[model samples]
Target chain A: MVVMSATTLGTLELAALLTVARLGNDAYGLAVRRDLTERTGRDYSVGAVYTTLQRLEDKGFVTSRASDPLPVRGGRSRRHFTLTGAGAHALREAERHTASIWGGIGTSIRPEPA
Target chain B: MLHVTPRMRDCIGAGARARVTAPRTESPPLPERVLLRLGVDPDFTDAVLGDLAEEYALRALRDGAGTARWWYSREVIRSAPHFLRSSFRYACRYERVRLAAFLGALVLTALAVLITLSARDGPPARLAGASDTVIVNSREPVQLPVQVLDAAGHVLHITGVRYQWVSGAPLHMSAAGRVACEQRGDALVRASFGALRESFLLRCRPIRRFVDWRGGLWLAVGDSAQELPIRAVGVDGTPETMLAGSAIVRDSDIASLRGLRVHPKAPGATLVDVWVGGIVDVIPITVSKRVSTSDALRPFEFFASPLRLSSGQTRRWHIPVGSYFVSFRSDTAASATAAALTLSTVGATCSRFGDAYNYFCLAAKDAALVISAPGGTSGAREFSGYLAVRRN
Candidate 1:
């Protein structure tokens, strides 16, 4: 069995994961770029996002398809990528790892249900 | 609601003006649009980006610029929250004003319309015995624009009408026609050239301040000093006083004179009179701003692929009486003449069709012009080609 490690990712890697997960089936280069821009108020390059998407797909985290191009975009085909089950699992594991490390830390507080 | 800083408001207002004035191109790329949509309301986002886009384009056009459109996306990202708050506040205020104005105007207009309908006469005095005011001034010959509708209101295909400035400058004529005027003695005289005939008349009385009444086709030159109070007579020697003023003359204004116009104050008309020492004849008013081709030509039909050109111009090739497609590309410092553009129906090439696409390519800087014909002949007998190239 391939064991999945729970390790906290850096800000950019974590952001990339969150955007892909937020977009779900619609998670593509443009989608992730838009997701990060909306949630974090930041602009990411399409080429950079696409490259990261390929990296995530190689790690068994996402899949992509060449969708029909919009008429106004000079008919450039849109490559739409979707997060896989592995991606969702990794996101959860990353959260758990962060929580475990910060469990005993005094400054970090987790609110209990009312 | 978001508290807008004065600087932000100034930026937004400037952006709006830029959007209104910018020529239609320079829309943001797809990725930028998507990013803009994520943070701000779509309409506000579009408004802000559109303004920025126009500013970018105008700057590019004026400064001979390169692309810096990424600034729009960066700015949107930086100011998303403030923009959303401002947009929401504006929408609320605008809605309240719009509703009140709409309701109030609707009620008042309804009441006024009802009162007007109830007070209508069987025949209004304004319409009674008031002759159809034909606007014709004859002080100077009227210069008509090419392909203007004639007096019968038919589109007269005047492909060629050339005139040289002989004594005084001539005014530009519109799609309708124009009136020429001269103030002889205390009365102002007007004339208009229509269908190869001149209508000369004297202003007998001012009816509607500036409105001229062409009582007849030709109000002959008249004498006001002699025993005849009505000395003005047409070429037929009929005594007639044109109950008109020089105000109906459209497309021309006395640039030097205190008050003078060539055409009726209608839309799409320019009143341009050159200042020549207070003399109306010294100003050439009827100058056509649009340049037309020497001859009209129809494109040959049935081209599988349009011949490609590097002139930074959009090229379209249509199948005769069929749907057509246009392929356009623009680059820095391109020329229509430099492109080895050749169009062929199917794979076969004809000698006559070699120069077809060259004439159709309209040249510009850092922009593309696309035109498609909707499945019909342009009805041109002979087409001449010209290279419309301009170096920046």
Candidate 2:
């Protein structure tokens, strides 16, 4: 198997990619937004979500296809995103990098007395 | 459970009644015009508006309508700038190239027009005609020479003089100062010399000759023929053929006498005898020879005769180059009462032949008409009609 280069992703890119991967086939614009909001407990704007999705697409971390228009969405196609292998690799690399940075920090700091 | 008194129950009943009678206070839908004016991509606009509407309805049911409305307004205001930016970028992406091409074409057109206008502003020369109006024959070209003169009538030796026909006649000037006339009418020719112009009126008269019903018949049979082989036609104007070995006329004359024979005794007196299909007809033929130089001024007219055809038969008529209107009428009562006869031409084919009479407009030198029964039947169908040339 050929190994692909791992791309560096921002916080929003990684979050969106993770949300897409977790949601699987149901990962769309509004669905991803709701998932992100529920997980982070932060009110994410529609523009911020879509703009981040577009940026991730430009970076080739994710790919999107428009679904057929649904009656509930007023006949507008849904932009559904899927995580690529490169995106999964990048996510693994980011996790590994974060774990390495925090490997000894737990021992160096002590919790406050209860 | 807590025990309730009658007064408490009455107050509770009154509160429930008030709640039941209260009007709904849900927030109204967002204005579609406002969403459209946001200049968002159509897909995004639709999806976003739909998402907002769906969520708004849910929130109105769960939370209060007032809170849902505030949430919707905040979301729309926050997302407006992003949609506007994306829409602007998308529009500029393709429109920049189109705008550049349009500007380039406009500049090229302006340069071409300027060059043309500058080239037309050269020397000034006028055309002096021999007469204001000239008469010519339609059959032959007429020579009308014009001298290229300066502003003071001094002759100028110009090699390239452009000539154009304005109206009334279709005539063009060749290199040797000759006017070619195709049709007979009044026409105006204009000669231009670098912006100076002269107009002349020309009247073209049509030449008179015998109509060549058969190709090369006029040459084969000289203009002064005593007898000619004119095909014998029946009273219904259909060509009649005799049965073989039938001794209706003399054996020697039967072969020579194919059509109606004509004999002119003098300049204005003649006789014609037609015998065909066991029927005889004597028609008088008159020839008048009036010689005049002004004969070209007279209007020309064509002679049209009625022709008859049977089922699955075709007939071709030779005519001059002009417009003609042909009308077909069924002759047989059986065919006419049962179904309409179909008539078709070489150029224009009729869509349907349900009507009794069919009309066609022909604009050719030669036209052929074919008659047939319904469904390509070879029944005994007959039709007689006349075609006349339109004079314009």
Candidate 3:
């Protein structure tokens, strides 16, 4: 496949990568907690940004499954998440396209020593 | 019309505590009074409600709403597990010794219950017969005292005896008068002419063949084969009298039967004098090892107070052997000057047909006594009964 170069992607694109890779089908507040902890080596309480998952779902990058009510979790239904094929395609295209643009740099502004 | 007035609004300050110049942590009276009138502000109302609910829950649990409250509090304290974190961080904090001690106590409690049940089914002194009643003869009536007497002239044991006389061979009066068998009410009295006061339990043999023994005779006694053992006694002053006669030795026919023996411990707690005879075997045991208390009586709650033994004073007692059957007797004043008191074991409770005062206790085992008496002046009172050792 011919690699196309692209650069300067939005924060939304990086999030799309995380959702598609680790949380292919079943993901939600808990999955996001695991993914963020794995990627960043630091824990973030997922309660801070569950609304973002809903926003992503609305934007078509992520899909959600309303889970059954759990007793221990205070009868709250978990909204599970999954990244669509379109989401994965967007992420891979972002990565390869970004790498291609970086590869196409003819020369550095600082000239090479003779 | 009733929107919070400016004064009320100002009084209900923001969620944060209002600062004042005073060093003491006292609320300014004017602002406090205003806030009381307005109640809590709506902005901070949710937090206040939450705090009140939490306090209410805590108080309900601490006051003991019962097991359900305790179970709920136990569950709520547990935190959600962090899957990324190691459980060892929490597990290592528990004390090793405390966990082991709890398990050890539970095992000991279970062991104690098992031992108690096993000890309850131990063998009795002896089994007299397979059935409750054994027929001795076929034709004539017979009479014998169900109670047994010790050599010390005390009643030691009591049991029911039945007799059936055959048609042809009636229990006849011998020339010596030492072996005349006759029926007296329920007892078959085999009175010997030479022997002082002793007889044998006569139950008719099925065939009615005359079995001749050297010295003794069988005197069968009972109202009927079905009647229970009658522990008949009469009290005269300090001692209870067993109206029946004592035990005597016949030939091997009655000598081989195991009979109960009574012994008296000397005042200084020394040697014991054996009362009943015909004990072919004797075994001495350490009294300390033999003495035991009933589980129910060990925790008996005794209260001390002045009391009187009324006319209807009666109490049932299940006492052990080697325990003194003590009864308190109130003595009238010797003169007008001094108070006189005396207590004694007033009855013979042994096998020998004599005084069994304080002798109701058995040897090395539990005995059931039904004592009925009026309550008397309560001080620290002590009673001792039978001390049972193995048959020698």
Candidate 4:
């Protein structure tokens, strides 16, 4: 465990864990990056995605292992990331926190000035 | 960050981040070196660069090679701040001792600054608005503050000065320079600090409210000068024997002050100012002239003329200031033998007689006298008398 103490996850860290959970066995830095950009409609940098995955791994929310040497990029091992038990709990916590913060806000029209 | 030993890394399985040798190949040399310099984790740096390279190849196939290269460069610059911060974290994880030393130095510098500021006890330039004397009224005691001034002439709250009562009875002050007085007296107060010394006169007086008669003082212009009985009131507001205050007559021509009494010199209007400290009580006196008449013995004016009254009926008179005789006689001689009349002061007897005759020497300034005529049922059916007085 990373320091054996819990670390809080930011938005990007939560999203990376969700992407890793969705990808199942195929989840890696490149696949997570592509999913985040296409789904969020914002191009997240490769560095941003890897930094979040590193943070998630440090929190013990996600664990990473090197895949067999891939044929792409003249034989480089891919760091495939997967959701741990803690990652599933972290995702549920994120959902509840989001709901609590957005619960009482109203979707009403603005009032006219006097 | 995980503090993984080389043995732990080799034996890592599930839940363990398998440390890998990030082979430096196919990644742009300059960008890879820049990522290392910016403090990105070595394995994460490899993963990030490889992902960028893979996306670049795909974008080159879909868009153009020029666009892919430009996009990659833009992405690297946009992501620099995050990479720099991540590198800082990596350095903290590795260099704990160096980081602690830096934080300790920062805290020491802050402590030094605080100590220097607290040690500064600025010297007072002078006393603020020092007056010649401070008067403490017995009613309202004088209140003076020891306000020290800064070099810029601003009044600083009293600090660091020892205020002591050097001499003066019935007056006192606390070490903090608060003054108090109980009775009419004066005190000498001195405050000193370092080489500077300041002194103030603390004078006290008694007299809170008006120190005069209820309706004011009115004394007559007598034939002989009289020592008027004036009242002196204390701070408690009772005008008894409390004579702590001094009374002054404003118009000396009309009335002159002999000790505490006001001796009238002329028939005029004047004011008497009774004061203790600055508090003053005004007494207005009207010394009107006395209406004099002939000194011959005249019949005293009764409420009724001919002095007709039923038996045992009494009458009263407020006699003026004079030496006069109180006498009464029955008009009927038949009833006079059994006739009896009693004339006396309100509380004491002045004169009384039977057999139709009453005479006595009664001298008074301002007094009320009562006289009543009496006849028994067998004596006479009517009883009457005449009362007379002569101004001497």
Candidate 5:
């Protein structure tokens, strides 16, 4: 049987995938949110991070497993996420597509820094 | 260790001062309460509250308790809507499946309860017997009354009845069609007639024969065939006094006891005369002395001293309170002298020698026996003796 490729990732899904990739073995709900805030300079809610991660998992872009409960987290387990091959390919494809679209516009526009 | 700069030291001091002055108020466990009130899924609520509390604690340590509380409140409020929305969506997605499962479980529980009630309250059984347990003597047969009835309380006559023993032996129907128990032990008797059947337990107890002393000479009845056993009941069918060491002569022909000696353990004991096998005999002798608590002690060899005693010297040994029969033997150059020794809480002294010495003494608590050689004796003396203490 022929296997169809997974569909394109949404903005939050792509961001979550990249955050999981950057987090390596430490990718989880709170960790990914922290990394997203650090990179994007915007605090993301824990719900958004978890929901996007769950959607990524459904899209086969990421997989998750529960870690043992930690006392610091009030004895709650961490749902750790990992990027799959599809997720990595999607990231690379999104990057290449963005680069191609930017390649056409190149240096023509200058934006003010925050 | 890294050196602390002046600015860092100042900042640390300020932070310490702030901590020292800050009110030691604990953050109420609000996240858990919020999750409970919102009816969030347990799995998600725990992790969410944990993450919030962990971050809150970190911020509290770094910035201040007030800032930490504000941050935590904002995070909780911002995340509440998202979490609620997601949880609602999840519930909606699986609502049908969960409802189906719950309804299935309810149906199964109702079905189980219905079956149980039906089994318990259904029509009354046709055949029923009285007394699930029947106790009878092994030599005697017990008639178990059985009644057959319809659903309405009317008695139905049984055409034919059959009895069978599920356990034990010699369980049969007598010529009159009654159940006969002839052996000792337990038997499950099941009676069946037509389509109706019922079962009951039969415990055949063996007749106990006892031979004990009673007023005069009386035969006692007991529950066992123990030799010299105290009779639980006398020949007059009255409860007999239980005694220890009472002579029990079972299966004795009284007519042949023309020369039998009736020795009472003590005065005031009544000799009960009973007839066994067409012979007048005294089998159960009820003693007047109630068996004392001290009688619980079995006959035991209390003390046996192999040490030799010299003249004018005494050896004392401690013994518990009880009745003891002591026998002493002394060996001198002339002959081995056997002496009866007596010792009690009160005054009692015996120095006689060269005979069977049987002295029964009642020892008070912490009583000791003092064995001494006669002051006039001057030869080498080796003394050895044993005390037979009677136990209740």
Candidate 6:
């Protein structure tokens, strides 16, 4: 059977995928939220970060595995997220799509891409 | 190969929520309890709550504990809806078939109970504020049919039963079981509640119809017998209990009548005459091959409620189809002598004897067993009697 590709990503989904990619081996809910907060200057809730990661994982753009729990009081196992090959390809397509959409832009208020 | 850790045995947050010594983090009791109460997936609980606590400690160090708690509460509120949805959706996807099966069973059980009660499929019912008799005098709608029992001999208390007419009558019966007078005729109706049956005579006016004797011609050859169940009905096919009895039949080489049953010795055709309350009828019988069923005798039970008889009053009962010796007796000697109670049946051999109670044993060669109490010189008129039947 022919496969249907994952749909285009929303801003939050795109940002979450990139954060998981950038974090590499260390990516999880808290790390992703901190990274997104630093880059976007918006302190997103961990719930939103986890939710987006879950959605990306659902779309096969990311995968996740639970780690051994931290040996501390009230510490629980962490769910580490990883960017998949589909995620990388989707990111490249999104960049291409955006570049194509902005290619003809020339305005006094906003300059066109170089 | 990867080594399995001790933690790996547990699927996160399952079983117990017991806390152990760990690095100080923000898993405050109230918010954690609230988040847990939101019914998040247990597999996700350890990771989700762990991440929240870790972030809580870090934030509490940078900001104050109060601010961190405020932020923690906000995060819990934000996460609750998503976790709930995901958890529910996960449960639905995984347990879809089982859930469907369970719900189907529940629905079927409820439907069965509903159907049973609506159909009134149980013991007789007592209509609220309704009499034992159903008279269709007016054009009115009813809920269900009523079963009526006669108030003679002994009163029968019944409810939630339906009227079944033995023959057609000049009476209009509604779906709700209300009876209306269609014409000036009487029909006997019977209602059976499994083993217990109650029959009543329906009267519209003066005209009384003859009770129907429901049976077919039967003849059994050599050592074979056939049960002739007599159903007494009214003029238009309703039940008539007054004329329910049988008469004697000749014990011949061809066929013999044993109570209401006929046993044939030889083949060929024969006519058997029966009488009930001065009414005589002859039915033809044809005995072919012997049937498979046996006519072996078994234990029997026969009883009647204590009968109270007035002067010159007579009552009779039909011998049920079987080989049995029936006995009738007055309750006491003084009452029997004063009442002059007599046990007699036409065409059936009977012997009278007994001083303690005016008692007599009647052979069940006949159908109708008549008991009469006549006023005597001793001046006592009314008396009670006990009737019993035993297998012969």
DockQ, per model, reads 0.01, 0.10, 0.02, 0.17, 0.15, 0.21
Judged by whole-model lDDT over C-alpha atoms, candidate 2 comes out at 0.53
Task: Estimate the TM-score of every prediction.
Answer: 0.24, 0.33, 0.22, 0.34, 0.34, 0.36
Model 2 residue runs over 4 Å out of place are: A1-6, A108-114, B1-32, B93-392
Q: Which candidate number has the best lDDT?
A: 4
lDDT, residue B256, candidate 4: 84
Q: Lowest summed lDDT over 10 consecutive residues: which window, candidate 4 chain B?
A: B5-14
lDDT per residue (tens digit) for residues B21-80 in model 5:
111333634653554344234445555566676677788889998898888777777777
Clashing pairs in 2: none
For candidate 6, what is the recovered fraction of reference interface contacts? 0.48
lDDT by residue for model 2 (B70-166), tens: 8877887777766665455433434334434655897999999999766643344567876777655334555566668756566666665666778
lDDT winner between candidates 2 and 6? 6
Q: How large is the i-RMS for each model, in angstroms?
A: 15.4, 20.2, 18.4, 5.4, 15.6, 7.3
What local lDDT does model 2 show for residue A114? 58
Per-residue lDDT tens digits for candidate 3, residues B1-392, read: 11222212323323322111211211122322232222222312221222222323444556644442443333222211221011111112232233335458868999999997665443223223222332332223333323333343344353333333323334642323222323221224333222223334443332222222221111112111121111221111122112222322223221222232322111111221121111121212111112233313321111111223333343333443353323223433457433333222222243321243222223334444333332346653332222222211
Q: Residue B80 lDDT in model 6?
A: 71
The interface root mean square deviation of candidate 2 comes to 20.2
TM, chain A, every candidate? 0.75, 0.85, 0.65, 0.83, 0.86, 0.84
Question: What is residue B94's positional error in candidate 2, in angstroms?
Answer: 6.9
Clash count per candidate: 21, 0, 75, 1, 28, 23
Per-residue lDDT for B138 in model 3? Answer: 23
Predicted structure 5, TM vs. truth: 0.34
Which residues of candidate 1, in runs, are more than 4 Å off? A1-9, A107-114, B1-392
Candidates arranged by lDDT, highest first: 4, 6, 5, 2, 1, 3
